[model samples]
Target: MKDIILRLNKLFESRIRLGIMSILVVNDWVDFKYLKETLDLTDGNLASHLHSLEKNNYIHVRKGFIGRKPNTSFSVTDVGRKEFKLHLNALERLIKNI
Candidate 1:
């Protein structure tokens, strides 16, 4: 129970980060504005979380140009996808036990 709780807690913690991660998992690529709007986060707040995920190698950012305008997209890497799934499963197991 403790182990299951720990895993659930890890994912439950860092709400902003988990939100960003969950969003990235669903889309192949997502823009900053989409994330900001979806999460209803301020610019600075969203940026900070995105940076943390990038640093942790849980997410990747691609900066490029769209019609000569600068664009940034975020996506979760394979490692991140796997981790998210594991955490979700941990929660499921915990729920099942109870």
Candidate 2:
């Protein structure tokens, strides 16, 4: 149990981050507005969390323009996918142990 707990990724400890990763893992590309609406997070709040993940190289951010409007999208990287899977496995182990 202790070993399994240690396998949990600290980056995913926050619900906000976990939610972000969850959405990114399944989607190819997700726009800022879509994530904000789905997660119901304020701009600043979401930005801060997104920044954290980006800094860690867990996600990739793309900035572009769509019909004269600036668009920002996110996707999970290979490293992120592997790490998140390990974290989820740890969580599953912990639950089953309990």
Candidate 3:
């Protein structure tokens, strides 16, 4: 139990961050607006969590313009995929133990 707990990634402790990762892992690219709508979070709240994931290199951000409109999208990195899987496995083990 302790080992599984220890294996959990601290960066993914927040439900917001976990949700962001869960969405990113399955999708190729997700825009900021889509995430905000899906998570039902304010722009500031979502930006803060996105910044954390970006800082950790768990996600990749791309900024561009769709004609005159600005577009920002996010995708999961290789490290993120691996770490998230590990964290999920740890959680699964802990749950089974319980």
Q: Best by lDDT, which number?
A: 3
Q: Model 2, residue 12: displacement in angstroms?
A: 0.3
Question: Model 2 over residues 35-94: C-alpha lDDT tens digits?
Answer: 999999999999999999999999999999999999999999999999999999999999
Ranking by TM-score: 3, 2, 1
- After superposition, which runs of candidate 3 have C-alpha atoms over 4 Å from their true positions? none
By lDDT, rank the candidates, best first.
3, 2, 1
Q: For residues 1-98, write the lDDT of model 1, one tens digit per residue.
A: 88887777354368888888888988999999899999999999999889977877788899989899888999999988888888889978988999
Candidate 3 weakest lDDT stretch, 10 residues: 1-10
TM-scores of all predicted structures: 0.85, 0.97, 0.98
- After TM-score superposition, the amount by which residue 70's alpha carbon in candidate 3 deviates from its true location, in angstroms, is 0.9
lDDT of 3 by residue, 1-98 (tens): 77778999999999999999999999999999999999999999999999999999999999999999999999999999999999999999898999
Model 2, position 47, has a per-residue lDDT of: 99
Better of 2 and 3 by lDDT: 3
- Show where candidate 1 strays beyond 4 Å: 9-12
| Winner of 1 and 2 under lDDT | 2
lDDT of 2: 0.96
How far in Å is the alpha carbon of 8 misplaced in model 3?
Answer: 0.7
